[model samples]
Target: MKPRVSILAALLLVSVCAKAQDVNVEVLQRDLDHPWSLAFLPDNKSILITLRDGELKRWTPGEGLSAPIIGVPKVWAKGQGGLLDVVLAPDFAQSRRVWLSFSEAGKDGKAGTAVGYGRLSEDTKRLENFTVVFRQSPKLSTGNHFGGRMVFDGKGYLYIALGENNQRPTAQDLDKHQGKLIRLTDQGAVPGDNPFVNQPGAKPEIWAYGIRNPQGMAMNPWSGALWLNEHGPRGGDEINIPERGKNYGWPIATWGVNYSGLAIPEAKGGKVAGTEQPIFYWQHSPAISGMAFYNADTFPQWKNKLFIGALKDKNVIAMTVNGDRVNEDGRLMTSHKQRIRDVRVGPDGYLYVLTDESDGQLLKVSPKR
Candidate 1:
């Protein structure tokens, strides 16, 4: 014999489930001009934001958006090239230093990715003693593919991601800084123990080679490992945990094809000898951007999960990670239809996001009461 369930009983169960999954999203600030990245201050009461048009602003709960901070270097502001990522020093409370990445214009109107840092003035209106630490070598003509993400390993070193400058072949060239993950000391010195230090014709600053346009990178709090996401030509957006001196196959062994719909001869099989494979890849590109791990205790349901901002998909993706592999859990802000430029786990244990648009916004997501 079978037992029948009543409609009222099922309805009650649905209501309870809906309430348990409720989340709230609030717009903290709007009308930003193509905001690119976000970083929370040590005090947890203020945040720094980078605008692609070469302006930096600070935001606070009580004072709102602060005036543009001076002392930033001039940015190229071309297609996909402009002021990019900003991060506070690990010891910012005492040192008051902050790092910034941008598209630096060079001679002959060429541009490339560059990283710099300066101490924040006591008045919070300017950067003092600004200095350019590293610059991508052999600046190219194209303005696209200036990968400018920045992340610190919590070990006195910082990593900078760079693009191939729309020149796919450059990725495999060790002599050039294009399409490489570069490591440097906190003071911008290339460590003598770098992977290619002893190799001839290779840049001593390169930690890994053959990357495409890596837009996101972070250090896992649980494992203390570095993870990154890169964009492919047509498809093949990839997630990788790159190791020292490894070669992440880009043009030569990608799951993507040319923009003109031509097959990549070397990537026909999607694998090549001596090249590292991505842990996971999307057959269709979502144009992945910044990412963060949900280690804050405020959201019990999202604890230990990884969140990545999607530009083309216009959403924030939540993923479940088990060891080295990851699976997509869900998407956030789909209904809003805004391109997510960055995702950050704030110091207050809530999630903050920056939307990319002429009238971009900063948003916060938290558990609903």
Candidate 2:
């Protein structure tokens, strides 16, 4: 082929790929007021969503939004503190029980991730009993970066991802519960089957440690492998698949450097013997927050793609996944880019996205054409 003709063909290929990548985004009920998290009931008739400022609302098809679920825990509501993820118990249809994670204020105004349980009133008008079950030990003063995404594995164990809380040194310490993924019973005790259960002086509650600000975390439907995305200091954002009892190189080992361009020692040699390496990493820091694997039939073509929301870029990126490899695909950059908070697949197979402003909206994805 001639040089000019080859160049033209290459350009045409690029245009075609760009046109194939598109997602139609729409505002499905704005004025959400910083809605931070969401979960769907078994019935698929309603979605239970939480506002950072302590109100929980239910959205149904014809009824719009019912009044907020009252009696939620008291929250700090300043900085990165507020009501967080709301998950239904595995047997919630019969139990009517729900689990919530929030930053509860302790003595001296300290805040920590406290997992609590609540009962949905008959009319779905309120929450009752509302008991605090598990709380992170030694709550800190800086109320930020509570990695509160919760999931229940098929083994009936609850997996909780925790943030480093800006306390870098503690990330490698076994004494601290922050900066770790913990395996706990529904009643909040460290299960005997956990990886670190027999380690001495180490918290048995820890399933995996050495995480920084894990903003987005999820489990793959096919592999059931736990995957997560965490923010880096300035660059070095990472997507990791942690193994039980493994220490992920956080401040100690990362591809990112300091925000001011100062050199921090590499967390470790990239191929260190026992350490877990991130499956994917972004050197420029996408400021990733929430993540979910697409298994819904609504977008059958997008099945198994990983969706992650970027705060700094103000875009929702869909990536193609093949085993551990991911390549970027489509993106929906909305005008309401107030820091995309979380992205999860709804029961109906649509995408539900959250934003991070004092008054943010819950946006939905629809067909563009």
Candidate 3:
């Protein structure tokens, strides 16, 4: 069944009292099973989408969605572990290279996040020369909290965010890959200048540690700073600027409490001496997932603003960013009532969002004519 498109006749308000331009939410595709991420091809019209069920598909406005592209690697599609993120190489137009992050299996039924790249066939029907370049260390049996978001910074370095795999203490363990942000060359080689390269017993790829479950990562186009958002225990969802060699306090200092409604034992009321503090946080978690920064001309009013997908809140959060500080502007698509999985700013300057559901949908938010 085709999902209904919602085109609001009334202008969408950007803030409590300030009114914004009218916009419409149009369903571009429907019946997607757990769509995780999307990347716009150089053509700006074609898109590659990854499904959590371990399939990659292509979609174009008039051509519709293609059959699952072949040659995808095997994924441990259990719990939060599965095929998660897909992005094109910075030189994709010349390289035809595509990168992917997914949950891979290990001995004793353990699993961890893995990354690889492959060339997209000219026909867009298969991936060629796919190779696994990196894998998270010490795979565990737990099935939750696999942070699989991948981002390429202005310097052509790739950053991979990882979850703690339900083990909180590991966030502070440099020896473990869980709950850490890893930086690597495009080919997955550790840079000699990495913060932990000379630190014994630490993973050389470790860029920063003490993250809980980072689901949103993006490089700000204006300032070239890497920004991230992660889930908190009961509340305290946060927006952080991840810097090299910095430690982001996770379980040790969070604005959230345990699921049992109890205070975190190690947290000194959500503040720690040596850990970096979040630029912005929510006392009530929104379960943020994807991140995008608007630097386009299509929506002049939204220029330089940040957009984040909210899973639990089921809305797209719009935040105004000035330098390193952020403030909530408003929410969008609240009436849709679907868990937002991913969001991106298309080459045409429109906003594309994916809804997380059994019958998921790809929606485009454009100015209503």
TM-scores for candidates 1 onward, in order: 0.92, 0.90, 0.93
- After superposition, candidate 3 runs with Cα above 4 Å error: 1-22, 367-369
Overall local distance difference test of candidate 3: 0.87
Over the full model, what C-alpha lDDT does candidate 1 score relative to the true structure? 0.85
Q: Candidate 2: worst 10 consecutive residues by lDDT? A: 1-10
Kindly list the per-residue Cα lDDT of model 3 for residues 87-149, writing each as its tens digit.
999888888999999999998898999999999999999999899999999897378889999
**lDDT, candidate 2, 169-264, per-residue tens:** 677888777888878987667788888788787878889988888888788887888887888777767788777888887767766677778865
The TM-score leader among the candidates is 3
Give per-residue CA lDDT, model 1, range 1-369, as digits (tens).
111212343234323321222458899999999999999877778999999999999999978999999998889999999999999988888889989999988898889999999999888899888899998998883678999999999999999999999888899999999999999998789999999999999999999988989988998888889999999888778888888999888778887787778886556446777888887676667789999988888878888788888899888877777777666656777777899989999988898999999999999987666
Against the correct fold, how does model 2 do in TM-score? 0.90
Which residue pairs in model 2 clash with each other?
A: 34-360, 252-267, 253-267
Could you tell me how far off, in angstroms, the CA of residue 106 lies in candidate 2 after the best superposition? 2.4
Question: Candidate 3: deviation at residue 238, Å?
Answer: 0.6
Q: What is the lDDT of residue 317 in candidate 3?
A: 86
Q: Judge candidate 2 at residue 104 and give its lDDT.
A: 79
What is the C-alpha local distance difference test score of each model? 0.85, 0.76, 0.87
